[model samples]
Target: MSSYKSIPVTMIETDVSYHKPSQTFRESVTLEDSALEVMTDFTRVTAISINPCASLEQARERMVSSGVQMLFVTNQYHEVMGLITVNDLNGPKPMQAVSENGGKMEDLMVRDIMTPRLKLEALDYEDISHARVGDLLETFKRMGRQHALVVEKDTSTDKQIIRGVLSTTQLSKQLGYQVQSSHMAGNIAEMAQGG
Candidate 1:
């Protein structure tokens, strides 16, 4: 039999707040910084996700509550089926979908507007590891996307896994300059000015 002693404990104090999960980045970064410095590594942070059958409103609510602009659409098995972004919820896509599919806006599902996995593109984790923030920004500009995914090969399974995510919004906050989505700007300077 093992004997144990109780340690002294203190009573909970009022007005004491709990710590929230937070990711730390450099206070500021230049475009020449490593791309990894700007990426949200899924290994460190849980990726926010929504079910494919979830309503658009539900997806929006989840994004707002989670403090993220994007959510991965997962199936019951938790496989990535697609992804939905704030733009997809607020842009003309919803209306267009309703118009084309003969459904009410309220009837729309996340999958109705999400970018399917087959249509998505990702950066190789190895390439990103060797790339600079500037290179990533240029890639975003060239691809006309606001967000980019990084995928790494799982050696054991030999399958690609979503390793991290990079967003222009996060880049803008780090750089202390607005970085407009590629669809919204012709160049970095234009992006800053546009914002």
Candidate 2:
């Protein structure tokens, strides 16, 4: 039998501060930079999410509090059912939903205006892994989307798992310029065409 000795303990310091997590993004990045530099990797940071049945107000509150423009609408099992963005909350979708469903604004749920999983699309992580920021930007412009999901196949389950997200707002922050939305581009094109 082996005997274990107790180690001596020291008193805790009152003025000591706890360590906080710090994630640093490059102050500036060119389009030639790696796409991974702009992606919000789920492996490093937890994704913000909300219940599908939650009120639209609740969804908005969560996004505001989290400093995110989008939130995944998850089921009880934590499976993503859809996603909601700030545009869906503040745009005409809410009013349209109310008018179509004959419900008051307060009665609207997150699912009422969220983009369903069926309509959503993702970029394979394998492709993103080798892509440049410019390639990602071109993809976003071609798709006419402000945000895109990145997925990787789970080897054991053979299921697609959302691994990260690419957001134009985040890209803009990293690039030191605003990435125009599709709507903005459309308006610019309209003016150019003298319509």
Candidate 3:
């Protein structure tokens, strides 16, 4: 029979030279000044947005070619109005072809299925990957969002505001500073055996 071992969760705490008062709760790490900082600047957001009135078919084609999952739906005023996802295009009631329904492309537009512009801003991070993760966690807490439109400006009429798109999966992989559970516990077990 093999001997068994128990492992405890590892939490990191460091003292800063110029310390702000610490948080007073278990979730203090996230609630306190975040250990993870997310960012959205001009550099990261450099693409042009899609027109909200465009045909859903054209929109789907663009996402497929660009290899991105989300698009920024802009209005005549160039304000961010809504978001559309690849999955939305492929959903059961996805944008139906006008020909299939005896309609035309002009009759079918993106605004129909788009998640309305509730929170159209990007979640920022210091680390791109981690920031992305942080953005996603925040997005989910708010609910009804699958993508974040990364932007550089917030003004309603800023025509220069074409930012990158953020997917939840990409952020999680690169967003944390904590050691992986398996790595830490495995190393500890090895050390215990050696002693």
Candidate 4:
């Protein structure tokens, strides 16, 4: 082994351009900033989920306990298969299932009443850059959705990932106002009448 000499280390400065300015941090943000700012990013909140085979009553209980209007129905591998919402429970799906099967609410499965994943629509996270809260509110109203999923292309994995969610209820609470959905009536006759 050879004897080694120790040298004093000098502090290395990072490139100033790489750092964000303090003013940028101090700037007051508004709902108009970007949809991303208003969105509940996955990094901050975990998606609430339920098993697809669970009973409608169980699903309702889970939703009540989770304090979410909807729950992602997952399979054995924990992959999203569909989604169940308070609307589905309070609507005709469960009743139709009960009528068809001649069984009680407990006999109705979440999968039977869930809105399949294929029917779900998502917005690109990049699109949020130019999107405003008002725009999102309008979209929710037009689409008759309480929540909207935001998908982002992960650079590292080179895959599209569900990155965030925007909720009308949450946004309304934050804004201190109610954002009503245009599809609230949700009657088939009204729907067929071009509502």
Best candidate, TM-score-wise? 1
**For model 2, which pairs clash?**
none
Model 2 misplaced regions, further than 4 Å:
1-22, 183-195
lDDT of 2 by residue, 105-194 (tens): 999999899999999999999999999887776787778889999999989999999999998898888877677557434332342243
Tens digit per residue, CA lDDT, model 1, 115-162:
999999999999999998777778988888899999999899999899
Query: What are the clashing pairs of model 3?
Result: 37-125, 37-126, 38-124, 38-125, 39-124, 39-125, 130-175
- For model 4, residues 105-153, the per-residue Cα lDDT tens digits are 7778898899998998999888876887656766786787888888888
TM-score on alpha carbons, each prediction: 0.86, 0.83, 0.47, 0.72
Question: Model 3 over residues 83-169: C-alpha lDDT tens digits?
Answer: 787877877434354435656544677876677787455543333444333334545445435545544443686544544454443
Error of 2 at 87 (Å): 0.8
Name the 10 consecutive residues with the lowest summed lDDT in model 3.
23-32
Indicate the TM-score of model 2.
0.83
